[model samples]
Target: MGSTEEERPEGLLGWCLVANVARETLHGDSGLDLQHGTKHFSADALLWIPPIPWDPGHWRWPAVGRHRGNSRRYINMVVRAEDLENFRVKGVYSEALVRSLNGHRHDPAAPRTLQNPWSREQAQSWADRWNQPREPVRIDGRSHPLLSVPNPPPAELRVNGETLHLAHYGTRGAHYSRNPPPTEQP
Candidate 1:
């Protein structure tokens, strides 16, 4: 027997719909003036709606510019099945708002060119790394060892009079701190 809706894996169609609803709701009343781009449901939530895909079929070549057209872009938003249901119940969106999304489901007979690159685990790992807080490099003269000196001093060093902190010095890139380093002793 086919899996029930609860057991069936959530499809990309659902995420795309939720994202559209979120963008419209936020843009209309939130006063945040968010541009037409990816929108996160919450600061702590891993879910987000990616930017709307560009339909190359409608645009001329040079007008397309830097955005290379691809079918994969259509299904890039990853979301949990339960989250979609919860958002619906919480009045984050209405069923009527996304009713048309049902019409856009991919046909089974068509070749599957738009596979999701990330599994749930992979998406969680990426979100964890992206959201991990870095310890700000000490520049307040509290006598902590400097993580590493910036190779080429960061622009903030000159503009804001601050020092850069390398979270994983000699490995990862620099992150800036507003506090300046302690003045050199004679």
Candidate 2:
């Protein structure tokens, strides 16, 4: 049996909400199992959780959260290497801003932040709301869900004879030379 590119199961790419304290302790399996595993879904376009450190000025940086005391932070579930192929450039989100969300009590009806070992509902809501196109918001002065479903950053890799170059989002890049090191003249 064989499968075509389109036929292959669209790789699952989504985030799971985990507690800040348990951020480093939790594994993909445990993260997936949170919220009764209801938030888990077949992600088609993008998988990275935003507020990446590459841009500290962005709102999501440091992880956004509702205002409340003794509140536990939320960290996105880590995506596995095998799943990298599913992402644009194997784009992996940062775990830096562990507790980086705007802790504002703007709306009294807004959902409250959860503490360590978050409850199933907290996990579910976070996962469900992530990158929801319908829910409009601005980040880094840009409208989010950027059309309801954010598209993966554009990535390209090319080789020119003796050099290899790879770039993504024009924000970062990598280059390498194929030539061997010069020999020492003794």
lDDT per residue for candidate 1 within 1-186, as digits (tens), equals 655565434443232212112222223352345543224233223233222333323211110001113322222333322122112101112232223222244344533322222334443443354333323233333322333334543434332444444222322234444554456999
Q: What clash count goes with each model?
A: 0, 7
lDDT of 2 by residue, 78-130 (tens): 33322222112121132322223212322335333212223335545654554
Question: Candidate 2, residue 76: CA error in Å?
Answer: 14
lDDT scores for all predictions?
Answer: 0.30, 0.29
Q: How close is candidate 2 to the true structure, as a TM-score?
A: 0.19
Global Cα lDDT for candidate 2: 0.29
Error of 1 at 184 (Å): 6.8
Scored by TM-score, the top model is: 1
Clashing pairs in 2: 62-100, 62-101, 63-100, 63-101, 64-101, 72-115, 133-148
Cα-based lDDT at residue 24, candidate 1: 24
